[model samples]
Target: MSQTSNSSSRLSALLLAAMACAVSPAVVSAQSADSATAPGLPATPTPNATINLIRLMVERGLLPAADAAKLVEQAETEATQARAAITAAAQPAPVAPPPLEPDTVRVTYIPANVKRQMIEEIRSDVMAEAVAENWAAPRTFPEWVAKYKFFGDVRFRYEGDFYPDGGVPGGTIDFNRINTAAPVDYFSSTSTAQPPSYNADQTRERFRFRARLGSEIDLADNFTSGLRIATGESSSPVSQNQSFGASGGNFSKYALWLDRVFLKYEIQPKAGSSFSAIIGRTENPFFATSMIWSNDLGFDGLVLQGKRKVGENLTPFFTLGALPVFNTSLNFGTDSTASSGGGKAYASQDKWLYAAQTGVIWNINNDLTLKAAIALYEFQNVEGEVSAPIDATTLNTTSGFIGSTDSSRPGFAQKGNTYIALRELTNSTLPGAGNFQYFGLATPFRELAATARLDYNHFEPFQVSLIGEVVTNLAFNSGDIASNGPTQLPGPRNNNSFSGDYEGGNVGWNVNLQVGAVALQKAWDWTAGLGYRYVESDAVVDGFADSDFGGGGTNLQGYTVSGNLALSQNVWMGVRWMSANSIAGDTFKADVLQIDLNAKF
Candidate 1:
């Protein structure tokens, strides 16, 4: 290992030397001048403070002193001659003028055809080399091991709570005063006001591993297939405890799942337009994703997509498809033994989902970027019934809506009065030989959504971004929308009265300051930010309490402060604190501390 390491270091230095020589413009400029002064003399490098680097390296035994001195002497000689020639050429000169009664003007314009020919030649050479290197040609195998690329990240974390909550309260104050000011007593034992489930003990530890493998292969002149296998964890909307349900974490386990698998055949069936029909599972191509670069909102189905780039900065993208939607809530649940009758119940449906999204990217300026997209996504339940039985008097299924034909229906009616679902009786698994199923007429029930994202990064030392999204279900426009369908599955005692409509929106703002690293180049590179988010869910079910409305409450507003500190070029640590208050004065607070080390192999 040591021998290999030493050899690698030597190779790195060789490459650095080559790069330094290539861009040594100062030395080159002096050599060019010296060439004019003494035509037959060999050009030399210019003397500069940077050249001292070579001398220092030689002294430290990092470089050959003999070679370094020879190069330095040649450089100085060239610089001196160049300086002399330039000085001699600067001597005073006299100018004479002539007058003429008429003159004929002539001009020559070189055709860009010459430039095009030169570029084409260079391009052909590059292509030849790429083909020889097996870099440009598609792999021979469609599977097994085509051309694959892999990437991922790892993180380490450390957390310290000095005050155990708010860092000791900032001044001389009584313990009673501090307790009253923050109201931690009513919310939690820790001053942070976080749920006991999220504490992770005094100092928490968390690790994440994300990796993706992608490859593409050609089947014909215009047909190709591609696939991606990725493993990663994503945050969920539902509470962690409820979301994971014993998968072992509020955070789901990482598993190898297909992010995309599609086959495409180009259609030249035009002059200025073209199209491609893609079949299989792939990104829905709708919605704006910030945390995940690839399509976070992917669906399984067929898509007919088309693209046209009128100019360098303007392009239009369109896609339409009938996709399959997996119930994220149910998909992440842990019911491993439920099939054996020992875990939480599950609900699922059997129905085809669909979605469509069309958007355009308009580059108005170099520094400013803008995009607009409109999308429609529908979630359909496939299974018409839930077979999982919880116990006697209870049917364990995946969810309440999963076992029935009208799984997507919001609520039921009881005694001429509508009430939201009391519970899903089908989540429990029954003593059965087959999985439960549901069926329903395919409906184009759509969620109309729009988003606007502006990235203003050209302003220089600081980068700013503003993003916003708004979505609403057009079918359920009214405040008291109700589902006029069967209330429950076949059961001994049928008691169903559930009806409610929930509509909500969120707005948030963030500001950041990038601190300079020039002052403390190694120990302190950082960015500090402050953010605020306001969310409100209106017209909740009449029975559910406000505190249980959304993730936090019916109406939520939070203030957060965070920063990242760099301990090295490849490693950094981050911390964030958030304090949120419900409309009813309830508080939900969180603190996160994390460290990350990143390097490429």
Candidate 2:
């Protein structure tokens, strides 16, 4: 046998002998004798293998140390003798040896400490490779998996909507539907479409749910990509909630819509100074309240934002972005439909929004901080155009007006914006009573807004904050809209002419005060806030404003009281109440109550 092989056999024999001592001597003799020649034997046992049984017996008062030593020596002697005897029996040549007395072999007990030391050396010799190869610890995934993160949130809500008892018959006109949806042929004798309107005096209650799941991946350098999906009905930009028992709901499955997909790259030149660029359908880029942009609103476009630290406790920031509000179809006005106005092709009327904002964060003292910002939002090609005069003598108003400027009508709306007919028809050709026509926004929209917030965090877990904002529609021109005349009204108009009601304003403002935890994160964390808002007609785009205010959209004034309490980590419940009335248009009043349970991970 090789030297290494011989040594291994000896070490294995020692380990096996010690193991068999716990059994009987006869078993020790047979097992230990065969271990030395066994194929595929285990690696050397731990050092304790030599004296573990003996020490265990000693600790348990089952055997004295001296007696254990003697038993070990006796086991080793018998095992060796059996191996020798078996070898001799295998020899072909005749060889006889006098046997020892009655299968007895003399024994010399080796001290337990000495045996342990010897076995420990053998263990180190054989286990060296395993330790070097990291055999004891292993991993489950590639290192790249560490760069990805996942998140999600779910909300369940119960809400009630109440309106005043008194109002003009037929209630308030659902102008949002009138402006957003294609104008129907309400005038035709066989028309199936009716003028849509809201239930002004009715009370409504509903259950709704919202769910979202998202993931983010970190790429090389400072680049990141993210994706998210959410549940909603019709995928409204201002809401992610899907009402229960709607749209053929009989325990029907819900649909998930792509809510966010964005790529971003960022760089930090120094402490508190950084810049970033983001693109795709993403969260809003500007820091603004729901008065200007709803909490659930997402932006589709590109933005570049940066911030620079100027001296201690002061940082200035700026943002620039371009967003496509709506894209005109390639053939919006090429067909001989009512909207096409006698098959004449029209120019592109794609709507877009360009914005620029500057803001600053300043630390007034150890306990107080301030944030302020000013932003200008400009809309391009978003104004309506009165169509060319029609030939009155040979006139025929199609099902709905489809003129060159029809595409300027908003793709979505929430009411309260002034409106004018897109087609110009003379008195002789004007639609008779019961005939219908479509309308577009009366004035263009360009917003200039200023906002400020102050926070006192001296209370640590409890903080106090004041937030305020004021905005003006710089593009509003009442005189020009009036000159167009014959504006759309809320109810039936006996004459096809202006109602002499401009019903428009250019300014809006809001103020809010908050107390308690800045954010709800864990059990016992809570927050309470009270706020008031006034939005004049045409002050802000009704489609993107706070969807829960005055049944949604501008031309409203209201007070909101809300509170949130975290019931557990990553779980919270909230309650809010809003009471509002119209600033113009139809006379209306509403009260909304909402309770929500929210969870995130």
Model 2 is weakest, by summed lDDT over 10 consecutive residues, at: 488-497
The model with the greatest lDDT is: 2
lDDT of model 2 at position 446: 95
| Candidate 2, superposed: residue stretches over 4 Å from native | 1-140, 169-171, 185-194, 337-344, 390-401, 426-435, 485-499
Residues 162-273 of candidate 2: C-alpha lDDT, one tens digit per residue:
9876543344556557666765544345456757776678789989999999999999799999999999887688988899997579988888999999999999999999
- lDDT, model 1, position 91: 87
Off by over 4 Å in 1: 1-205, 218-222, 232-259, 265-276, 290-297, 311-313, 326-349, 381-445, 460-463, 477-595, 598-601
Candidate 1 residue 33 C-alpha distance from true site, Å: 78
Clashes of 1: 42
Model 1: what TM-score?
0.43
Per-model RMSD to reference: 31.4, 19.3
Q: Per-residue lDDT of 1-601 in model 1, one digit per residue for the tens?
A: 2443444345447635754555345554544333323332223333453345444444334444455556556545555665676677788787675664477555567689997998999999999898767677675434435434333333433432211343211211112222112112211122243211212114333444335566666676778787876554422211111122224666655445666688877776544356788887665455443211122334567888776766778767777877654333454224333333345443454455566778887787987777778776554542122233323123222333222222332221001011122123332233431222221211123456666666666754445555565544444322222232223422211111122122222222222233333222345666665655443322121111111111222234455566766676655666666554432211223344433343221
